[model samples]
Target: MSEAWNEGYFTDVGYTYGYYREINPVFQRFCLLLRGLAQPEPAEGTRHCELGFGQGVSVNIHAAANPGRYVATDFNPAHAAHARRLAAASGSEALLVDESFEQLLERDDLPQFDSISLHGIWTWVSRDNHEVIAEFARRHLKPGGIFYNSYNCFPGWSPAYPLRQLFALHDRFGVTPNGAVERVEAALKFSEALLAANPNYLKAAPQLTERLKSIATQNRHYLAHEYFNREWNCMYFTDVVDALAPAKLDWACTASPLDAVDAVNLAEPAQTFLKGVDHPILREQARDYFVNQQFRKDLYVRGAIRLSVAEQREHLLDTRFVLTQPADQVPMKVTGALGEASLQEDLYKPFIEALAADACAPKTLRRLAAGFSGMAWPVLQQIVAVLTGMGAVAPCQPESAEREARTRCRALNRHLCERARYGNEIEFLASPLTGGGISVPRFQQIFLLAREQGRKQPAEWAQFAWGMLDAQGQRILKDGKALESAEENLAELTTQAGEFAEKRLPVLKALGVV
Candidate 1:
């Protein structure tokens, strides 16, 4: 195994330094899809396993939302520790094991999991590692369990593979991390020069320019780890299918529901011609011709069981009501041919109006649909999809008045950045583990004062800062309407700040300068 495969290296630098904790909605939706497919519900104490649980953010969120036992494993000990901490903090009932997939599969005490997920690992690991993961799924996944895997694909990524190779060569030649970055920059500059020198470069220059720009935007740490990693590779979707065939797993569906919608897939005469092809490899080729896919989230199942459309509807109903948007917000008017037009025709006006009023909770939408008398779950779902597609609706967790107050305070802090005294205070308020995490109410009070007397910025940090604060505040306000009052908001902010001070202040103190 490479040194990167060792537990210590990943723990000491990889998981701790990177911004790896952001929520992945694709994985979350996959879980919901699994929940639907596993209907006629599994026996109690059903479990799910995540093969490479880096930082445990995705699995923790899934475990929190779904009622099941979760077993997560990572080859990196640091990742396992971080995952454990996250699980505990989030009150997620997930068991974290610091072991490779191979070692985990060899254990006799493990139970067959109802679902298995592996993300961002398959394309970056050795073939042996792939075999181990496949073998583990074969041995431990229940007969009808679902397996989800996401990876980089061919054709779309083929153009960039050479660029990656060039970067790897530079990384090998460079002495320091910054030197490696400079070397990559130099290589990109050379490519630009080459394109400028040759008129023939026009055909390939666009792709090269895009690749260069992408690498330029990437974080230094991410660039080093991603390109320098010894095992990075991309595979064809069909090749991945062939690799997993030995494990008796078969493709259930593509993770994206939008991909499955016939209208989206069948647009041209060529699409119709391609759909009739029986061979899986041919189908994939046709798909590539139709769409140059760069990545895919594939869902696989062990058995051949299929669900009826009605069963799928019931399963969708069983999904927990996750509020993606406020209840009163109205959706934008649809001028085009809406999918399942009959379903959307009657409710389109009302749905748009309701969505416009305020962003709505999913439950509130359902209630509104029921009142419409002509509404069906499918129709409502489609409307919600349309609204979501339009960016009119969002999922929000209920917040208290205190949370609202804090958001206002944060906004105030940003605007005050031009005033040296207030700017310093704003920086303190904006610290992630400290001020950023503080309760809304107290932050609100501080912000109100700052806003009244703060210096005006010659530039627009306040605008950028407001954008961030507004997004956070919108989430809180939409989720928890309880924090609407000024007094309630203030109280909540105070409590939040106190909690932050207690839990995160020590780290801040140790770091010293602020």
Candidate 2:
């Protein structure tokens, strides 16, 4: 709790309980294969390390859902305690510690990790810490291993830099309470008032007005850490590559599946221009300017490996995918720098419907393409890529891995569902099939608990949930207003439970969460 231990990092408020899918090894491998790059194979002894694993949600989920060893650390003791508790409940055997990056670097007991990841930590720390991280990666990352990192980047943040500076200045000079939330509220109020005064700076940068308005609507806890941090830096793509050079890291591809699809992200002219740019690093950084990219999720490798066309095709056929949402409900369009583009329903619909069959089961590209006679292999591949980018589908682990991870997944899911009875802070459940967290809301988790307790009908499940809620003086909200009577709350809950049983329960069952 001491400020000295926090170094420049924000510790007055805890980080959000968010589950980032990019940290999952199964997703990382799929992203690599999409770009014709070699990835670390999913094996029984795979090891992963995460730096600054806030709330430990993603690390815990991955440890329980995948057959591997996970070692992670967050400097905040509160975060480490929460993460360790989840690991214990799942029986995941993860090693979580509350040590700073420099402290972690001094340890001698860590294994050579197949993957090393840090999300949203690169830009918020000092340059010395960055050096520590690069040195840590250099010492612990195995040859040909993957390194995942996400950070706020340049060009997109160029105009918004002044706005953040103003916030930091106000937090330093303005009268405010000691609490992080209070400081954030006061800074936002000052910024809003300053924008209303029509200053000359606002005249030069018109976009800051709208951006500040949007920032005001975000989670206060998120805004506190994001804007009020003591040390903040943004870099260009080339700068990041240079920073990690000591680790012998080469840029591989983006962890975001959508970035791999040029058709969606780049205009024809932009694509042609990028093709003419010979340097890979220059081309990637140039592409960012066209899109005004602020945030990036990137993948780097110790030693880059290029896959041949024949091998790429062979791997595609063997990889499996599963629908994360309902087939019919999936959007027929994807948005990117080019704006919204419509997907060919004739191509995507049949593929989605096939996977949705047999209770939304997982299927390989070879088995799926067999159903369609004349579809080309490239087209099928693109379909999967686009669907994955839209978050409607996810790459799945092999059956052997899923079977081995099922017990751990079940234990974590049970623990999460039981916690849902008290609060809705965490809203994801581990899935053995996907080797990642799936978005299952709090009420749905409550329904899962009801079913496990032998409640069969929707009415029975609703009644069970109501008893838990009513005991704590909680009421269901309808149309943004709390239902005043128990009857109204029960009716609303029953309707929701009925829809859950019909639509979501089947998918959860297939994911082995039910």
Candidate 3:
């Protein structure tokens, strides 16, 4: 019998997948680098394939933006089904396959793709499967095709690997879920006690105690899942480069271009040290180690092709910002009559106003929160996501240098937050566990699920929402209690129904059924 792949097991024993909502600019840049390698235009309909197309959200977004004959494949039937549903919902015309990489490669009937992307699947699969992936790229990838693969990297993750092994051992011993949590907590506590016992703990690094303390406080689900995966392993960058050498593939660029930003990029001395490195793999590893890289997304190319940075920038200039026409300028695509009626008694006016800003970027929305100190960050983030989905604002390019600077600054903040102790709480709450806000497609979903069903209200929610709205109305509302007066109750329900109407009305409008 084929080995059973239990999702609960994966959830209980593997690292949770990173759920990024927006189009990753780094992936876009990688595509530009590939286009330069292939000498192709966006209008040329380059054939692209994605391996392990989880949920197909990114593929759908790409298909909507770039017209192409795209193909996607995944081994999990459930995941493939979800991808198909999303594609259908998004009206994207792309072929999705449910099969293994080996089987797909063996088929002569398949179309030759110009680019193939495999993100977050390299280290999780068996070694033989990894070889098959490389072999498929060799035989099927066009001579100048671009292949992007993202995987866990080494040296930085070395200390964590032993912890993972211990978790795996405990998991095999039939430890209860809570037991697993306790065991990890105990391990961390023991580590802390040892440090306390020896005041010379700073002899190794004073920061070590703080780091362990931070890890212990991370989400229990995250800890249990990531540290107990059976196949969790980290390989040196050289090992990965060698693995791809047989297929004549070479590291073209990084999927996350921000990772390329470092002291090496800043100083002549660091640059010279990087240059003297002979092996491409070793050079990357050295740079990563110096900077302490934990995760990576790298782009590989079959052959070398040169393009200037300016040319690359021009290629990526299409539809990079979200545009919103003034409320009166364009006919409201969504029915806001109900929203307007409900707006009279509800205290979410400031929250709604922030969402209604002519055409604000996410960064601007965040910065604007300072003006509304009582407003919660999580609530504001969700409100922005809801408005974006409702067609109140559309995606556009970040036009100003200020926006770019803010983006980089935010990334640096994220890096520092990942390594620090007290900052871990901020990182955890900002992540998907607290609904990163942008990931929620509709406001009604938040209302019906979080408000009506009495979900999403926790100590964290209060902390999260306090950053979005004024203090007068920031109190945690129990299920039906969110609707206080009859006026407020009717308004809340009406707003909820209106949101659904707004979403469904677009389809009718497109079909001339409205």
Residue-wise C-alpha lDDT for candidate 2, range 123-153, written one tens digit per residue: 8999999999999999999999999999999
What number of backbone clashes does candidate 2 have, counting pairs of residues 3 or more apart or in separate chains? 0
Q: What TM-score would you give candidate 3 relative to the actual structure?
A: 0.57
| Estimated TM-score for each candidate | 0.64, 0.98, 0.57
Instruction: Please tell me which predicted candidate would have the highest lDDT against the true structure.
Output: 2
List the lowest-lDDT window of 10 residues for candidate 2: 1-10
The digit string of per-residue lDDT tens for model 3 on 244-280 reads 8788887766654323323223356656888899986
TM-score winner between 2 and 3, please give it: 2
Q: What is the lDDT of every predicted structure here?
A: 0.53, 0.92, 0.49
lDDT of 3 at 232: 58
Q: Cα RMSD to native, each candidate?
A: 11.7, 1.1, 14.5
